[model samples]
Target: MSAHRLPGSGPLMVFGGPYSNLEATRALRALATAKGIAPENCICTGDLVAYCARPNDTLAQIREWGCTAIMGNCEESLVAQAIDCGCGFEAGSACDALSIDWYRFASARVTAEEREWVAQLPRQLGFQWNGLDIHVTHGAPSKTNRFLFASSKASSKREELDSTPAHVMLAGHCGIPFGETFDRENGDQGYWLNSGAIGMPANDGTADGWYLLLEPLAERVRASWHRLHYDAHSEQRSMIAEGLDNGYARALTSGLWPSMDVLPAAEREQRGIALQPPALMIEPNH
Candidate 1:
């Protein structure tokens, strides 16, 4: 319930699930610098460490970037020294089985000091842009490990949105970029936006991650999804070197996940098809 207000203006670059991919994290940092987006205006929706090599390096890089970040399920589990990632995958599912090795690898590599830093991260962040109140969380506002995807029911999404006073909820966890506007009974609209993940591709048959750019436009906010290109082969090599050649190692290049245990039917049907989520113009709340 620790929520901090982000102070800034102009465009905000929000991304999620760095997932311990150092190369992808570096590419994002470079992209932010190139766009002249200061660290204060940049927000990460968490999971800074997860399924990949170089967990400690990725943590260090994010700290050095100095962006505003919130606690993800991975951080929460690591701080508590949990035996699993706490990603909410089914107990006997493929995702749960695969998580065992990577979680252990990440837990061992992350230093005690790094865990301390993650423990202090807020559970949520809030900001105002062009008269719109925006709230950011690792997953749904109701649960840190909840998986809300593009195919989620509108009513379910609305319930989560109603739990907060903000006009927009920025979230990550399902590892896909999507946005939708929900109309409340009173006629005001709320937005659900996921910037996607920087550490892993969107299972779109290409080795590229995703991020979101939110820019102020008069009384509205323009939300655009962008692809993050990085050295996927190098990351694969690193994973192999670390003896972490789980299915994720190949996913780095294949742009496909090792398991679809967490994906909905609609999302599973869209696998391997490049995602073209339309840019949304977030209207001010009525």
Candidate 2:
């Protein structure tokens, strides 16, 4: 439960779940550089290694990028030398089964020094941009691996928002991009945003990942979701070469997850359908 405050007013790029996909991670870094977003203004919500072939390369790339990163469940498990990813998947489920293969692959490749670096990452980040207080977390404020999907209950989201004082709370881990605004009991408006994962597709029937952009406008902060197109085929090939031809490897090009075990009914029903999450404008606190 560590937290750190970031200092910057520039446009921020927030993404998550790099998931050890070196190709996708490299694409995102190039995007940030082309957009003039400094490394300090870019934040990663974690899961730097997971169901991909190049765990060590991806971890090194992100570390070299020098962005603000929160420790995801994958990082926590890796650092603790846990046997599983700690994603809280139900026992005997497909997610649990698949995780076994990738987690073992990642754990074996990640070095002691890299785990030490991940060990020091904060669990949360807070910052002020354009008069708006923003909070960042890997999953939920209460639990790092909790899956709070777009279709999750509104009350649940409100509870997480209530735990933080920020006007906007940005999170990742659900692998989908969405935005919801809640009218607080105290009459203020609160926003919950999931930047989605760049390592994997949104299961949107397209071979593209997702990222979030937050920019300050005259009177409001504009939060938008953008698709990240990368060399998915190459990544898939890499996985096959590494003897890691799991569902996630195929998911790179297919844009579909192999299991619905972790998805709620709403998210499960929307599988293979492209996502078009709308942009949200938040008024800065006066």
| TM-scores, all models, native as reference | 0.97, 0.97
- For 163-250, candidate 1 gives per-residue lDDT tens digits of 8878899999989999988886567888999999999999888899999999988777899999999999999999999999889999
lDDT of model 2, residue 246: 81
TM-score of 1: 0.97
Clashes of each: 0, 0
Q: Which stretches of candidate 2 lie over 4 Å from their true place?
A: 1-7
Enumerate residue pairs that collide in model 2. Answer: none
- Alpha carbon deviation, residue 140, candidate 2 (Å): 0.5
Lowest-sum lDDT 10-residue window in model 1: 1-10
lDDT of 2 by residue, 1-286 (tens): 1224374788989998999999999999999999999888888988989988998899888878888889999999999999999999999999999999999999998999989988999888777788888888888989999999988987888888878878788899888999998887677888898999999999888989899999989889899999999999999999999999889989999999988898999999999999989999998864
